[model samples]
Target: MVPMMMLAAIMSPSAQAQPAAATIESRAREVVALLGGTGDYDATFAPSFRTAVPRARFDAIAAQLQQALGKPTGVAAIEATGPWAAQIRIAYDGGTLNADLTLDPGGSHQIIGLLAKGAEPRGPAAQTLDAVVEQLAAQNGTSVFALARLGDGSPRLEKARNATTPIAIGSAFKLVILAELVRSIEAGERKWSDVVTLDGSALPGGGYAQQPKGTQIALRELAERMISVSDNSATDILLFHLGRAKVEAMLPVVGFTDGGVRNVPFLGALEVFKLKGVDGGALGTRYLAMDAKARRAFLDGPVRDTPIAAIPRDLFQNGKPLRIVELEWFASPNDLIRAMDWLRRHMDGTAGAELRAILSKNPGLPDATKHWRYVGYKGGSEPGVLTMTFLLQAGNGAWYALTAGINDPARDVDTLKFTGLMNRALDLAAPR
Candidate 1:
């Protein structure tokens, strides 16, 4: 999760440093034009802004905005202005966009913060929940599942097209870790603040892995990375320290065993990467033939022994193929929803609030928040797979959980398309 102070820095107005309204307005317009691709980043950005947001990243952001909301038609004059910052309403081809910009000091002011709100849903409602989900599934040509319950704990909607069928759901399996960690903490088995160090098995991903080896980290921070940033190294550190066997046992304990789908056994990011190093068919045959005990031993033996560096840095670089449907983590949409609900029930008081806070660290579905009083999100994606699970509380004090995943065995799923659909699905279910 981003440090709370960083957000504070962005939102906190500087004392006696507020720029004039005219300056804020011009800078806001210029930054929006840069993001809309009509202006060049190098020519328009402040020195610090240019350094922080390179030309390529700026271009990618502009392209994404174009793809997601279409070309920017116009931006309204500044609606709100703060010291070095301004907010504006923008009109796009598909929907409206709200943008906030913070500028540097002096006459050559540059944009230091350029944050954009996600596009809100704009479409006709379907007659039934099933029809809405099914239409999306048919349109995407993939499996889809969605379940939303009212604040009173009554079922508002439940629909699926092959949702129960297990598919690899990248980092969404981290939900199991977060839930189990909460349970362990409640039982006094582990403390969130306990300090731990990286091991040889530490693999590359987000957060601390980007740091040098042997960096000491707090357990609470590890959990934050797992949920908020989906950091792989943080996940492995927790799994290693918590014991994979315990997490394995907790799966069924959390109601994941009832689905009859085989619960994923002894798989972590590092182990999954190593598993891809061997013959795919042989690996499948050998793994499927193993009993539970054998699988555990296998993970502890050959899988654990594989060197971290031996695993390629890029798992998706053409030839380094992974068994997306079989070798990696697997969970049905129903299982994921149950996991979220299980976490909700187990997390209470300060512990619950802390977990939810970490989850809110990434407000992935901006439109969903329009209906929910609070929303917590965790999503996972890898080649050919994308999954998102949400724990939500409605404005009326109703609680609901929603999970959606899409997979294509032949190639990578269109990530932006799936994400847009997921946001739309939540918006459709928000009213109930």
Candidate 2:
């Protein structure tokens, strides 16, 4: 956590000086051009040089660009090009435009260049992006996760954990449900005030949220519970309303291939079964025969498989036994960043306000703020699986994407201890 003294020092009035108009204009134009637009450039130049630009700002910028560009653009695909420079690209009406910008120590900055069409990057920025990806892949994990930051339209750090391999997102998959709920509300399919009842049977064992019997809650309140509290009952209820088929069908539209929620809420164990008797009857046969060996195979496999039993055949499986049903909630580091990008784009509108309301209600903030700086996150845990991902908007506009998952075959691993370690990793990953 940034010390209170430091926070005060950074927030002090003297530290708050607007950059020269030329510099601000340059940066603004660069940001607009990178976003493929030049309209309504509203930005706040923080007084404290030490103050990181709020993640909310980046989200706002992304949202504006999406509105201008009329489609989803690569807002999170930004990376640092130098100690103080970055690059990004935005898809425009008929083509793509790339912009590179640089920030000076005094917050004075310039939009170095804006290409009419997207250009293939070369030189230092590209090299830096490649290097970051390699470094993330080398982390002590079996899965692949990468994060990139673009300044002035140049790639800085595109690091990956395993890069090529995919892992189960576990409870992080709830984000998909959250996104769907938001979409439904926006489409008039549902309303925030629509009351949904939660029954005891909907609860997942060992998960957070006590099963409140016959509890009546608004759909929006349930969405908040699903995300802020990681409530299994809320998620199950939302999933039922959204319909497994509708949710599964939406993944491809968002550039996800390997994520989808199973009809069953807690299918962690059932995911490994290639074939299981629906009733677990006499004709039943476990796909891998042994859970231990099956888990080993899953961990070792280059591409993880989602069991048909976990996701129903009619909803997800297209007939093949090993047909993968990637849950929208399961995000790679890139996926998390993408989701954050999406959230950032919608943050300025009703959707953004709703998300902010939900985020403010998250329980992790009070405790997590103790050691971390600018932590906006959603985490989920269950036996054998622990997942947490965040879009850590740094004290500078610099942002870091952190997702940590541990599929511990040994159920003895301490969750609190693991969360602490993950926090440490996040600290290390944050800009000094």
Candidate 3:
């Protein structure tokens, strides 16, 4: 949250006489209405307006003000100048005349004050915001991303890392699950307190929530764990309960097409779906090994005209071989951004507040009091894959949507290093 400061400079009445109080008040009220009623005066508008106009030029200010106020919501006001200042205002429907505003002097548009209308002051001055963003972008390395600042329900600084290129996004697809759960709860399909028991036999290797198989947990708890802690067991159970078909059916409504849980018991499903060389006689053998060289050669070689094995029998109960399945859990950057945008708008107060609480409790956060920014992320990783997607909210109301993915097969590279690089890139896109 940014700080709010209303500077009051008392100017003595001029001996030459000034405009009538009624006229001033009338103009002020008119300006207010033109700018979307009294509510248009938000924190985001103050600094820009203050910088663009001086109190002395009431008529000129009033004319330019009307134009600024007349634009539709989320559309930035065109730059205008008055003898004393430069200003911009964004109107929104909310409490008081809240704003994320900036002001600068008329002579050179030197920053005078940068404050939110009702919140506490954040440190960056208005004049430095753009520079900070540019500096950060120059320092980061992720391939595709976007940064946006929400003020009065509008996104400011909505810039894509590579205007058109799309990158593969990994685990970040879990946000889709979160969205579906919220929608289901909102639609009265389920309750947050509804309890669901976990079947331990369903836990995947190397994932959170692999223990206490029969433990009962609420549906909402599973949703939270799947996202906040990246718990696979909770995710698997939720997927099963929600049903793969039901979840996939909601993607179009959420503005997503290429991402969703494609298979139940994802790991096992993938093994079954992509069966290539596993033999039927290998059933019940937990320790079977195939040469890495041979596997790679087979994977890279040309395809044969003969029908490939689609299922491996004797691998599971019922004498049925596992079916090959591919979970649609990754997405292109464009689709990922659209999905995140939807989440930002649809995230209800309860879920958003809960996530905030969880993030505050995360032990990985640094102890520094400089106000660590809040970022909610859902990530997915596997051997030969790394993916992360997040919505970062700065204390100043600046927000960014970021997605990064690497499919390189080299397992030696550090995952933390990759994640750090993504974070650094986001910091550049939306600085504190």
- Compared with the true structure, all predictions reach lDDT values of 0.66, 0.45, 0.43
Q: Each candidate's TM vs. the true structure?
A: 0.73, 0.48, 0.48
Task: Output the number of the lDDT-best candidate.
Answer: 1
- On residues 58-90, what C-alpha lDDT tens digit does candidate 2 reach at each position? 444444335434543334344343443444444
Each model's backbone clash number: 4, 43, 37
Model 1, poorest ten-residue lDDT window? 1-10
For candidate 2, what is the TM-score?
Answer: 0.48
In order of TM-score, best first, we have 1, 2, 3
lDDT of 1 at 44: 65
**lDDT per residue, candidate 3, 1-432, as tens digits?**
111222222333352113322222233333445454343333323443443233333233333334423332332232222222212333432211222222322232223332212211223422433443354344323334445554444344455554234333444556666667767776778777888876644343223333576678888667776665555556666766786556666566555654333322222222222343244423212111334344333323321111234333212212111211122244555566566666676555545555444333322211111333766655554433455566666677655566655443333112433444454455455554
Q: What is the alpha-carbon lDDT for the whole of candidate 3? A: 0.43
Off by over 4 Å in 2: 1-145, 150-157, 197-215, 258-331, 363-374, 410-417
Candidate 3 residue 290 C-alpha distance from true site, Å: 25
Poorly placed runs, candidate 1 (over 4 Å) = 1-92, 95-128, 148-157, 210-214, 258-261, 277-298, 317-322
